[model samples]
Target: MIWNLGSINADNFYDLPHLPGPGETLTATRFRQGLGGKGANMSVAAARAGARVMHIGATGADGRWAAQRLFEYGVDIPHVAEVDSATGHANIHIDPQGENSIVIFAGANADIDEQMIGAALSEARPGDTLLLQNETSGQVYAAKTAKALGLRLIYAAAPFSAAAVAAILEDIDILVLNAVEAGQLHAATGRELDALPVGDVIVTLGSDGCKWISNTARTTRLFPAFPVVPVDTTGAGDTFTGYLASALDRSLPMPQAITLASRAGALMVTRRGTADVIPDLREVQDHDFG
Candidate 1:
């Protein structure tokens, strides 16, 4: 199983022709609701990519229904918990340029505890992969426990929290980040990207593609994408991370895993919502890498 410990939320999206400037409010072109949250979106993405993904997250009364959404994408929910508090949610505003601003209510997400990790870890075994991003509490706890249990741990250093990155870097098996995040780590030390000590680091460069660096290996590559006029890009990053996890579970090498992941990321750009955008494996196989 590919275990994901993170947040779950129902996304409320407002579509506007353009982003609103400061002190300016524009009428929205459209709006809709979808199942999202980096955790949930990636959970679905991993599942769709053929990994048996189990999401460990907290939900509230009204938001309990949101957990069912993951089932639709074939993600396992044996670890999903529903508490008495209100569920967390995101109010997302997306412009035609595919950029977005999100206001989050971290209700149930902020309330996660170590007990949740303990419960989830009870069923895990060695060789399973535990994937984590910065969406919940107990990341270090999860990493340490997964390592102790002989499970491989993959970390996506996102949301750029300095304290959190410092807290969890040593325990990660593979460290993944974007260019800005890679710059953040490099700037703090005034060293080269490869100087940072980690098993592996992936710096995703959007259209320029992603670079993979390790102590023994370093290379950059691009994935094939369709000639897409992106409509929304809210979940592209999550898709990449999720697909990468799926590929890794299949024992694909780093290069092949990233190629598949990049294709998945590109496919996500052609859609409107995070949950609604993930493409299946067959679509990626037939996709032109031009």
Candidate 2:
């Protein structure tokens, strides 16, 4: 089982001709709302990829539907608490090319606390998988607790925070990052990707591919991305992370797991929306990377 301590968001998408510049006003071409949040997306993605996923987080009463949506997507949400704050939401603006800019309002996602985390971790056993991202609070506490419990911890450093990474770096087993985020971390820590004190580090390069650096093996290898025309790049990384976590949880070798994850990410960019659109394991396996 995979335990995910993450945020749930109502993603509000606005279709624009181009990303709006500062102080610029432009009419939107279209609009839609869907389930999203770095944590929620990964949870759905991991669950869809065949892992028994348990999502631990808080949502507001107004956002009850999002939690229900997660349950419908195959994630176990018995630990998801309904808090007093409003549910979190994201304002996402997308261009014709599927490039996006987003602003987030962290409401109940920020209300997560030690008690919630402790209660959730108590339900997990040793060797269970734990997935975390920067969208929610109590990550450090959760990471440390999960580590002590002998869980295999995977961290998706979206909305990357160097301080947060530093606080829990020792507890993480796998670290996932985008190209830009990887650079930011390197610059902040003054260490190369392979030098980071973690078991494995994954740097995802959009379209080009991803790099896997293993500290234990002292090796770094590149896994090429599958070629596909992209419509919405949003959540592609989350799809990759979630699928990778699922593959890892199943004990697939790194190369095979990355191949599966690459296929999922390739498929993800071909669609729009976030958690709602993550492909299932069968879809990923059946997808022709060619």
Please give the CA lDDT of all the candidate structures: 0.82, 0.92
Residues 129-229, model 1: lDDT tens digits: 89998877789888888888988788888877777888887788788888888888776657676665576777887766677777456544444443556
Candidate 2 lDDT, 1-290, residue by residue in tens: 89999999998889999999989999999988899899999999999999999999999999999999999999999989999999999988989987889898999999999999999899899989999999999999999999999999999888989899889888999999999999889888898888788999999999999999999999899998899999889899999999999998888988898889999999999997788889999999998877
- Which TM-score value belongs to model 1? 0.89
User: Any residue pairs clashing in model 1, and if so which?
Assistant: 224-289
For model 2 the TM-score comes to 0.93
Off by over 4 Å in 1: 15-30, 94-101, 189-191, 216-228
Report the C-alpha displacement of residue 173, candidate 2, in angstroms.
Answer: 0.8
Any runs in candidate 2 off by more than 4 Å, and if so which?
15-30, 93-101
- How many clashes does the backbone of model 2 have? 0
Top model number, TM-score: 2
